[model samples]
Target: MKDLELLLKNIKNKALLPVYFLHGGESYYIDIAVKSLENDVLTEDEKSFGQTVLYGKDTSIPEIISLAQQFPMFGELNLIIVKEAQDLKLGEDELKSLEFYVENPVPTTVLVFAHKHKKLDSRKKITKILTKNNWIFLSEPVKDYQLAKWIADECKANQIKTAPNISHLLADYLGNDLSRIANELGKLKMVMKEGQELDEKLVETHIGISKDFNVFELQKALGNKNHAAALRIAFFMGKSPKTNPFPMIIGNLYNYFSNIIIYHTMHGQSPQVMAAAMNVNPYFIKDFAESARFYPLKHATRIISLLREADLKNKGLGANQIDDAELLRELTYKILNVDRLKVSV
Candidate 1:
């Protein structure tokens, strides 16, 4: 978040806050805030006496406050960070004890709370005080379409060059878990030369994703009306069901054509309008604009239906005769046929 970067800069400049509460589903920014405190809050000699880290399972909020009330020893600030604060065995009453500490916090102590995955009760007075004072940060998930742009930015932050649209390939394979994506990107960068441009081949080699046989490529083939290529990739998927499961393939297709269908229904809206309506990157509007020919409004609608039905079948709710691989081949065949004429599956 913008506030997070500002807070980090302030910490680096020794502009300290008495209390910090970082709660989020995505832990990337939370980790950054914690690391900033570790690196910038105290000197190497000061860290020996000025830093304390605790886990929620073993520490109480009252105990943490007591620790925070301690005076710094030969340092400008004493940093006490609490990780996984969500697991703390505390109810509203126990949490309220923090209100007193927050109201009259120690000048020498900087208390940081890394509450991962969930937020504390906002109705509580403690939450109200922290938020009003600008101490709480919630890390919202990156939008589904924004993942690629975020990945591209991350590549730059790591000093790695990436070929165009490589972020799209990574987003298609990795989903929107920023922590996991960073881990994979770190691995990919390790195997490359220092300044090598991250390409499809590098990703396929280091990240174990298929450059040619992934669902994104499958979608591209279908969008271009290349039935042979679509079927070929589907067969590759069939041979390796462990890696490419039916649900992920179906989910990707559902997202892919549903947007194309949205573009057609908008009926002559500008590319910018459709991009905003569909929450898609503006650069990809042309692909969906062209895709209207391969899968017209009527066919795109039916293909989504086929995908839904196949999803149910794979789940043993409607039908479960074939495995995911065979199910995918059938789904691809039906989608490609929708290009020729209206199809039913």
Candidate 2:
């Protein structure tokens, strides 16, 4: 799969391929590629007659082939785009027709398949042909652990300065939704002053995620065994169910303690080694080290069990009509005092 930049650069240099099969699990990159082809391939005057957009659900392979075979009416080339190509149902004859067209596509017509949210069937001959010719672009989803770096890269690409932890903060709040994170960054960029860096305060003000009271802060409080601070944040989070969903909080805690257990077992290793083992940034190794001191392997394992019980309770199993706030309070108390509570593993 070619990178989006390389693809756009090719189109910019007038080195256009006969066919572009943009299919993927991530729609953000796919949409960007499709838009670039739509706008960059032809001028406004040329697009009036040269450009044609078709939906996969409404068009067939034979129809696509027929269009691709035709020359441009008013411009030097014809640009044919098929959006939502994943929804295009294929039969035996249609598959053969597509494979035939891809193998010997028309040079004067540029055909693009904007297949979003899924990839082409690798088992199909057409997919193999696309790959062999470098015509396919696969936009794989970014992993949860990679979101912070992705955010940081995006900030850098936009020529924006940010605090070291700002990317991590945004990643924690936004999860792995590239489109939503990009939208929030776009909003921040609009209101940002000249030469202003994006810090936690700016993010809290613009993105609605509190600098203090978020899952990252709550994790810090728990890692250091600050009982008072943990309870305060938990209480605040419980009050705002929409912002801090109970299940997401529990899931984050589960991941936190699970990493602590891994850290305990990796003693004496370098920060980089441990960070790689835990899938966390090396900058956070010190924090994890402090957390490991507070939570031994046995304690961390037991806390994970406690988190599982809390998750079940949040799902209304054995909860006895307790509200999320109260459940959160009880769970926080148990986690902070795991040794004394003798939480079963």
Candidate 3:
């Protein structure tokens, strides 16, 4: 729970110690940590004299130490940043040397070890040495419950106000990829007035969600049994390359029907019980509930079979000239009960 503001303040004030290990699961923290060093640690003139960025896999500890040992050309200290330090060759020998260096790091140098993706093994001798001797900041990913708050905080930092639900919707649509989420939010920030609230329509218009529609959200609407809403989304998606990218669409379709099948199979179970039984998030139970209302176990099985055929057609089997848009529209009409079934007289 390290404070981002405190870290930024230390970087800007030049009050930070020489050695810093910024390793974490959250990309937002890792990105901010590195950028703060780049922008605030040294002046442009100081950077030209002593700043060096090195990749861990390519550069050994000896090489890093060699550079760190050198005095700044005309600056007070050198700044050595090791990106993706998890890939850096840090064996026993290197760890011993690094431990010693960290203990007595040159006052004329600043060494920053950045390990992104996941946390480095702090239990290791090298990591243990670092914790006892230098500044160590461990960043963890935001919990699912905290994601909306995190996004809201990010917007607030930029002096923008995002509607609460909008944040969750963005988080829901973007998945859990922090970098991608940040990119989308950054794009949204540009088009929004400073004090204006961001809404779903604003997101739809500016973010360029599939003009024709995407399987992702369409699945959500259908699962929730909002048939009308689902149909509208389906029609919109009919305008896009989504239908053209038949394989991807088919994949999503297959997953949706499969989940519905699973829900029906496990009907009469509690949300927790169903989630555990089907290996899905509990948050998805509502959609499954809605889907169960519209589809019996038998109908769910039939839809799953239809999706299987669609998958094959998209894969260039059976139908050689199956147009994605046409196939998808036909499927939508059937799914939404818009098309009447024919009976033998």
Candidate 4:
């Protein structure tokens, strides 16, 4: 993100690069950077004659070179963007020629590649040259642990404050597909007052998440051994299978217990240290500490095993004909019973 931000900042300030290779697994950041460049690289009047889009499946490396060599018809600089560059069929000789172009690029043109889903070949000589010159911007996906913090940062950047752990709730409900998360937040932001802090109620009302009852709340209930609350949430989840998939629920439970197990091992660590280690907010440290007392390492391990069993059943691998709600109910019952043998650790 920093590299893309820096690159886009330079472009908006008219400090354009001779070559830009945006490549990697994450498409959201790549799309944002590409759009910014398309909008800022040339004026609306200049774009008619200066800007051109090329696709990799249709354009050869030789064709790209030909386009790059052309002088701008009515502008100061020509803008050439190659979308899906990986699909462009190129032999070793063509790759060598492409390398030569970037090495001695057209100063009157701004060349950009929108490579999505995968990165360029790191073993290739051209890739080495691009990396050495800091021309390739890698757009990596956000780690699972970092999604909530990222959402909070995104909200802050858009001038909206989020209530305590509200972003975490969003992250819990919205997995980690950043583009979808951003789109939902964008819609939520339209109705939100400027400087208004986004809260659970607002998210529930606007984004259709049941802020009062979700897998996140269910996790909390199980952690605290609030059997009634846990069962209630599980029943709700089972009733609305469309909104709550068994795999997603199992995933959340697995992560929750995984943290608890880690917490048990680090017996004397401070809240800040533990929070840092677990990649969660310090405010949530208290809950983890409290939950650890209820679910020791022994129980956490067993619950993880139970979640795996539930996962297999959900996948229809030698499981009964029971519905997801029944599986969840059984799993929750098993989890609540796990504490009875907590001294195994």
Best by TM-score: 2
lDDT of 3 by residue, 1-345 (tens): 387688888899988778888888886787888889988888898888789999988899988888888888886889999998879877889988887788778898999988877787868776787777647888788875567667777777777676544665665556567778888878888888867887766777977554235665677666655677777776666667633255556655666677777788877888898877755567767877887787776666666666776666766788878677767766665555522333121
- For candidate 4, give the lDDT of residue 95: 90
- Local distance difference test, per candidate? 0.85, 0.89, 0.74, 0.85
Superior candidate under lDDT, 1 versus 3: 1
TM for candidate 4 is 0.91
The lDDT-based order of candidates, best leading, equals: 2, 4, 1, 3
- Backbone clashes, each candidate: 0, 0, 4, 0
Q: On residues 129-197, what C-alpha lDDT tens digit does candidate 4 reach at each position?
A: 898888889999998778888999999888888887788788877888899999998998899987687
Residue pair clashes in candidate 3: 212-236, 212-237, 212-240, 213-237
Clashing pairs in 4: none
What digit string (tens of lDDT, one per residue) describes model 1 on residues 143-234? 87789889998999988898876888888778888889999988987888977889989888888888888888898999998989999999
**Model 2, CA-based lDDT:** 0.89
Tell me the lDDT of model 3 at 72.
83
Sliding window of 10 residues with minimal summed lDDT for model 4: 336-345
After superposition, which runs of candidate 4 have C-alpha atoms over 4 Å from their true positions?
Answer: 340-345
